[model samples]
Target: MDLNIFREYDIRGRVGPQLNEATVATISRALGTFFAANGAKRIAVGYDARESSPIFAEIMHRELNASGCDVVSIGMVPTPVLYHTVYTADVDGGVMITGSHNPADHNGFKICLGKGTLFGEQIREIRDIALAAEFAQGSGTIEHRNVLNAYCLDVVSNVKMGERKLKVVVDAGNGMGGVTAVPVYQVLGVDLIELFTKPDSTFPNHHPDPTVEENLEHLIQAVTEFEADLGIAFDGDGDRIGVVDEKGRIIWGDELMVLFARAVLRERPGATIIGEVKCSQRLYDDIEKHGGRKIMWKAGHSLIKAKMKETEAALAGEMSGHIFFADRYFGFDDATYAGARVLEILSKSSEPFSSLLADLPETHSTPELRVDCPDETKFKVVERVSDAFARTHEVITIDGARIVFEHGWGLVRASNTQPMLVLRFEADTADHLDEIRDEVEAKVAALIAATAA
Candidate 1:
């Protein structure tokens, strides 16, 4: 088996090439063994709408059964629903077969143990067990359950949009969000315009990831054409959300976090809120100014979830669209529920979404830019950049290295899931932002040359 599918956060790889039946079976056996050792007797399994997901789930079920664990199959659903099963069902652990925002050819798993994420070293242990080729023998049953209706009802019950009747457009990017979100929106009494609502693994419109500007084109166009009050989009597994205002302007995750944080602070003053290091400084300033405690943590969904639990944070969000609200909803990232919460907050206020953002201070910033680097060399480049910055100036190493200068801050961090260095810069002025960007780019180039030498 190509064991690299055993990633830091979850097992993910190309369906046929890296994640064949044998490979997935081995992973299931390994997970079963790990859970059994930890006193787990029952596990939950859920799959997305990917073409390979059903086959993968069947193989996983067989392997888990062989390892002496009863599998509660939650059928095909969004990742959030699978996560919800872990809490609502009497399962020791749960696995969701989803590639998330990756391409359709890709499919893998995200796991949870009880209320916490089974990531980091836990993921590595599964690899070691699988590579050892150890298997446990037993007969366990696989039972199917449908939690979509219950999940939908729970979401509507918690989020009351009040009397503000607003028109909203939702672009599911042809993922599982269309299956669950449509029902929930229908029950919540919002005027809905659905785009790419059909569940298609082959994402005909665009890639499911809404964070990239290119992927959000269809959603923006539909928003403007329909003159909707707001536009929302979801990633493949429907755990992350991207949003646009009524005017078809991309609000971005940091700005969205500010809105969510503001709403949460009004209900619970001095509440702790967490944000990834990649978030804008304005987000932190705005939260603190609004009588909330802001804590900057590392990026990645698993890391952010763990931080949220540690801080008992009421709300947490990443620069990407992974927003987790622990206030009225579950702490896990649920884009459907988050989109509802956003609407609930906006619908209560008379001001337009654009005006709410316009009140904030403006600054020049670069969206996340990716620099090509091989997986083997990416971490080395980040280390070199960190070392160089440490030698000359102050740097924040909370995630990678955020080099702070007089004009602005420049960040260079290696993406955990890809072979690239993620960079972003922010400054009070465009010229200052450019200067910081240049300095960071120069450092990166120097690091690359040194590696080649």
Candidate 2:
């Protein structure tokens, strides 16, 4: 089996090429062995609407059963619903077959033991077991369950739409969010305008990722036409969210986090809130000003979730729109639940979404910038960049090297999933931002050349 499927946080690969039936079976057996060794007997399985997901789920179910772990298959659903099953059901662990925001051709598994993610060293250990070709012989049972109704009800239960009923547009981007979000919103009495709500594995409208500005055109246009209060979009697996306000302005993940943090802090003063490295400096400053402690953490959903637990944070969010709430909700990244929470907070307030963001200090910034590098050389490039910055600049190596200059900050980190260096720069002045971007780009170019040499 190709060991490359085992990634930093989850297992992912091209569907037919690297994630065929035999490979998936082997992976399932490895997971089962890991669970069995950890004294876990009951495993729940869930999957997204991707074309290959059902196939993978079947393979996973068969293999898990063969390894003597009773399997409860939850059919096609969002990743969060699968996560909720682990929290509410009797299952010892759960696995979801989903590519998340990736292209349809890609598929993967996100595993959870109890309420926490199975990642980092545990993922590596799973790889080691797979590489060793170890297997346990036995046969367990397989059953099916549907958790969509329970999940939907749980999400919309506490949402207060108030008397300020407003039209809202939702662009699910042909992802699994449509399957659950529409029903919940309808029940909550929202004047819902749906876009790409149909679950098409091909993702005909756009890639399911809502982070990129280009992917948000449909939602923005719909929001403008409908004069909606807000527009919400979800990634493929329905774990990440993107939002547009009444003026059709795209509210980025960091800004959304700030709004949520303020609302969360109102109820729990001096609470801890964690944000990923890519979040804006304004988010941290504003949270602190609002009597909440902010902790900057490494980027990645799994990493942020673990950090949230460590800090006992009331809330945490990534620049990628992966928001986790431990404040009267399950501390997991559920985009549908997040959308309801956003509406709940908005309903209780009189401020417009854009106005809330307008109050923050403005800074010129680039969204996440990607620099191509090979998987083998990505970390080396970051190290070289970090070492160079260490000699002449105030560099923070919390995740990558975030070099703090007088005018702004620049960050460069290797992506965990892809062979690319992610870079972003922010500054008070446009000229300062440009200069910082240039400096970082030049340093990255030199690192590439050195690697070639």
Candidate 3:
């Protein structure tokens, strides 16, 4: 088995060779043993709308039950619902069968031990146990509990809509997000325009990742055609979000966080806000301007969630749209919940979505650029890059190397989920953006070539 599927954040890889039935069964048993060892008497199991997800979830249920942990089966739901179940249900831990925003042929597991998802060393521990094959066996039971309705109700209760009703467009991209978001929007009395709401494992229409600009083509078009207030798109498994404003311009996650953070600071001044390294500088500055403390963090949902808990952050977000709100709701990354919160803020405003943050100084930036690199060497390359940059340039090595330039910044981080080095650059002008990006990209390329040689 390709154990590299055991990633920093979750176990994810191509389904057939890396995640076949036998391999999945073994991983399930390992998780079962780990959970039982960690004092988890009951575990929650859930799956997304992927072809292999249901079968994989069944394997987890069977193996976990055998390990003497009672299973709470929250079947065929989004990843956020699994997180919600972990919070609300009596279960001590949870496992989600989801590929997230990856390709259709990929599948994986997101594990939770307590309220938070596991990451880094925690994930490696599961891998070690699985490799050792020291299986724990016992007789346990599996019970079905559908938390979709409860989750929706919780989100609706937390969000207070303003006087104005909204006309919104949603592109679910045939993933499981629609399963939860559709009902929530309907209950909130939104004039909803749905796109690809059906759960299709094949993802026939488009890939379910809203992070990719190409994946959001339909959403942007639909928003424009409907002349909606805004457009919301959910990634596969429904944890991340992508949005387009009323003008059909994509509103990246950092900008979205600015809006959310400002709204939060207005009521709860001096609240702590967390943004990842990839976020815009304006986000942090805005937080400070609004009497909020800002923290720049690593770039993974599991890591961000843990940081939120540790710091008691009022709100946290990443460029990938994993927004967590601890203000009036449980601090977990839920796209549906975040969508409602954004809608609530927009409903109260007389300004359009496009103009909500016009006051923030504009800067030229690149969307996340991913360069293919081998998993084993990706971190080493980033380290070399960091070391080289630190000699002359000021750098922030919190999660990766974020070299602070004169007018803007550049970041190089190994993706926790994939075998790629994620890069982004921002600057005061388009020419400066290009100059910074070119320098950083050239350095990264040379390092990768050196590593290979």
Candidate 4:
């Protein structure tokens, strides 16, 4: 087992050296042992459209069964669907095998224990069990089941939509979202246009990540050509979502949260909503202005979900497009479900798609910026830079360090998934945004240099 594959959020790595049948099976057995020790009798397993995902899912089922846990297979589905199973199904835990917007040659497993995902130290401990080949001994059982129809119906049934007949385009990026999204949206009374509905492991059109502007370019073009009300896109596993307005403006996650909060607050007044450190300050400000409480927590969906439970928040969102709604539906991040919610909001309002966000205070913010720093050195570099900034600025060290300036805020944190440092800046103006970004980037460069020396 390669220790590096055990990330802070989910286990992910290139398929070549680190991930193979033996390693996957070993890790699965470790998970089974972990679950069995935790009093979990049955677990569910699902996979994405990635070429290796189904194979890995089968291996996990075998290993978990060997460890005495009855495994229910959901076949190929979205990551959120797997998460949905944890709540709707009778299983005690769940796992989803997906690359999650990574390159085609990469894949990994998102494991859950008792309806909650394991992260940080919990993920690292899996390596210890797998390396020692320590697994529980018992004969288990495996069975295949389909939860796609039930998932779609549950989402569609919960969300309330109007008869505005929303004309929208959905770009699945050739991922697994279309499997469930098509049925859910079809029943939602909308003139929905679907793109890349087929689940293709090769991703012949473009990568599945909707966060990248390049990936949303096609969605943008199609929305304009079709004169659609708006456009929505989903990542590989269909958990994260990205949006394009009627004018083809890329509506990021933070901005999307602004709309979601408004709708949620209207019904449940003064409800609490959570946004990560990298989210725009405008989001917090607007949420408060709307008589809703706002909490800024760490990134990562697992961390955000845990915080939601702690704060009893109605909603939570990350800058990278992970949007969680505990308002009308489940607390987990589901892009397809969120997309349907978006349409429901638009169907009620007569305002243009761009106008849905006109009430929020304006601020210029850069998309999350990532700098390549080795995993071993990334956190150290962030620490050095964070300490340097703390000496002068009012820095928030929730996850890494976020420097709060008079005009803006800058964040530099080590990415839990990759070998890099993630940065984001938001300011009152373009020049101020540039200034904040440069100041923090210079410190990052200096820290990297000091590490080399």
Clash statistics: count for each candidate:
0, 0, 0, 0
Instruction: Show pairs that collide, candidate 2.
Output: none
Q: Which regions of candidate 2 fall more than 4 Å away from where they truly are?
A: none
- lDDT scores of the candidates, listed in order: 0.89, 0.89, 0.92, 0.90
lDDT (Cα, tens digit) per residue for candidate 1, span 1-453: 886787878899998899888888889899888877777889999999899999999998998999999999999999999888887778898989999999889999898878788778999988888888776677889899888888888888889686888889999999988777888887878899999978899999898998998988998898899988899999999999999998899999999999999999999999999988889999999999999999989998999889888889999999899999899888999999999998898788787778888878888999998988888888889888988888878989898889888877999999887778899999999999989999899989889777867
Per-residue alpha-carbon lDDT of model 3 for 1-453, expressed as tens digits? Answer: 787898888999999989999999999999999988899989999998888998998888888888888999988999888899999889899999999888899999999998979998989999999999998999899899878889899999999899888999999999988999999999998999999999998999999988889999999998889899999999988888999999899999999999999999999999999999999999999999999999999888888989999999999999988999998989999999999999999989988988898899989999889999998899999999999999989999998899999989999999887789999999999999999999999999999999999
- Candidate 2's TM-score reads 0.97
| Candidate 2 global CA lDDT score | 0.89
lDDT of residue 121 for candidate 4: 81
TM-score of each: 0.98, 0.97, 0.97, 0.98
- Provide the RMSD of all predictions against the true structure, rounded to 1 decimal: 1.2, 1.3, 1.3, 1.2
Measured by C-alpha RMSD in angstroms, how accurate is candidate 2?
1.3
- Per-residue lDDT value at 143 in model 4: 85
For model 3, where is the 10-residue window of minimal lDDT?
Answer: 1-10
The most accurate candidate by lDDT is 3
Question: How would you encode candidate 4's per-residue C-alpha lDDT over 215-266 as one tens digit per residue?
Answer: 9999999999999999999999899999999999999889999999999999
